[model samples]
Target: MGCCNAVRLNKCDEYPTQYRTDFIRTGYRPLPFSFKECIKSAFYANNETGNIWTHFIPFLFMVHRAYNVINQFEDLTDPINFGYYVHSIGVTYVLIASTIAHTFCSHSELCFRKCYSVDRAAIIMQGCSVQLVFELYICPPSCYVAEGMGRNSHVILTLYCVLSTIMFCSSVHPRLGRFQRFLATLPFGIGSIMINFSCAVRYLYSSNAIESTCFGTTKGDHVLFYFHLTSACLAIFFYVTKLPERWYPEKFDIVGSSHQIFHIFVAISLYFQNRLIEHVTAEAKFKIETGELLREPLASACSQTVGIFLLTFITVHSVVALYYWKVQPTIQICKPPEKKE
Candidate 1:
């Protein structure tokens, strides 16, 4: 039923076959697809349901975080707090858009592909957007054109933004087919390289200063930092090579799958990155607002943030993998034919 209708009936229950037929006749149609597509479609729906809700529900948690951060600004001593507001809004918008797109994507193939592309773009955009807090902390907007030492952070941030743009664009047009996914790999590969370079520059130029600024700093922070770097490398590698699982084929479909592992690792990397960024930013914020830097006595809050994200990421993906395993048929692995040997 549409607007102005007296009764809005659920089509799947009320008309079933006719509902689908009417939808197609009205130009809202799914893909002209094979059995393989049917399997993919069902699995996509299942995965979308879980993935959207898992990430979407966290918006409440984010709102709480935002509230706390805003409250932290009650003191006039705090540096400009405007940046975080925009950051929070951007994060919330991405989550909301992602959830809505995924939920309704199954309406049609055109819808599905467009929504999936938007979904992927949201992932990339969120990663890039979150980095801004760090940029703002290390160097305020005024320092963007600053000369000498203060300029390093600004330069690195520009590079980071450029790479993120590339990633978002690649997802927007991941080519036309299997071969097209390869094109998508290029931007992520480049982004990975640029990020590593940025990390190195950050550490080499500003390590002690940054360390003195953040709270609850520890050796593990460095460990997790490298872990994030390694995962980024692995994400790029897997995107390009499609290894292990590709080598073994359908054997790893349900659990112990490469893509699933990649997703989990990506989430883990983001967790670490967020912690590190928060630390770095807090340090920078102290420096800009006052001549001195102060560290939070307890980084328990940051740790909790990381922990919740990891738990949610793993639990959601595990459920999705299980659902796909039980509902999907065993796919026969196919390799591109070798030259007529």
Candidate 2:
């Protein structure tokens, strides 16, 4: 079994060269193609060790945060408040998927690709969940046209999911070059920007359209929102550029690599998002307690929207898996022959 200790250290060229990427410059060791071996690697150390722990540690934090968020809510019946709980679940899913993808990706190319799919799906789900929470809180039924906003939110969620699915499929398509894969993933970031812009517009419009205190009262909220936006952008930039590592490759293989930096930025962004969700939850609860806001029953429209998203997610994964399996034989033939140990 490969490990990261000095005795077991493996340079970039020492591993199966087929798995090498510009980002995974060096200090990587190939793991035996076994689930048990992969799990053991997590403790021994390896190139993927850092990547795994970065997300895994944060995954633990997210679990704790999710629990706290759920406990804070007095009523799980209100959809608006319940949205935060759902958001927590989505975030936790993303973190855990990321951890698993990174930890065991070295086990085999096939495992890596499948895990990548899960990671991408989880990320898209997280983004959509965040958008849903924002739309619900920023343009609550008290301030906006309840029926119209509900429908709009549903439509937006469906469209975003479709776009995300397309992006994920294109990114992993065996035919795509490196540049093309990068381009394929760009839509996820761009879509997020578009959603934020729309939410900002809704906030402004809602403020002008009604005399409700439910929207945009906190200066800190705006600050955290922009901070998160910046963090997200930075994370994407580091990921795309493969910076620092690109400047001086192997030196960062074990630490301070661009991928590690990207993971840190992502964690920071999620922290800000959690804070924002907490702020919104507090506001909603206060309103409910003060009799300024009435607790609305969970909207059937919201349930339908979630169901549509789930269906789309499943369909997309199924199609991608089918395509992979269909072409996998050809892919194996084209790959370089494995060397005998």
Per-candidate clash tally: 0, 0
The TM-score, computed over Cα atoms with residue i paired to residue i, of candidate 1 is: 0.52
Misplaced by over 4 Å in model 1 are 1-104, 138-179, 205-224, 237-244, 251-256, 288-290, 293-341
Q: In candidate 2, what are the lDDT values of residues 247-316, reduced to their tens digit?
A: 8857788778888889999898998888887886787667767866545532442464355546655765
Against the true structure, candidate 1 has what lDDT?
A: 0.44
| Cα TM-score per model | 0.52, 0.82
- Candidate 1 structure quality by residue, lDDT tens digits, 1-341: 22214222222223223112111112111323333433343233222334445445655556676677667655433333433443465466556656655456545444444455455445544544444444334322222222343345434544444444334433333234344445456656554544455444444444334434333234555565677778766765654565555677544433344444455455556555655555554544556457455434222323222333334334333433443346333423222223454
- Cα error, residue 299 of model 2, in Å, equals 5.0
Model 1 poorest ten-residue lDDT run: 18-27
Clashing pairs in 1: none
lDDT for position 125 in model 1: 44
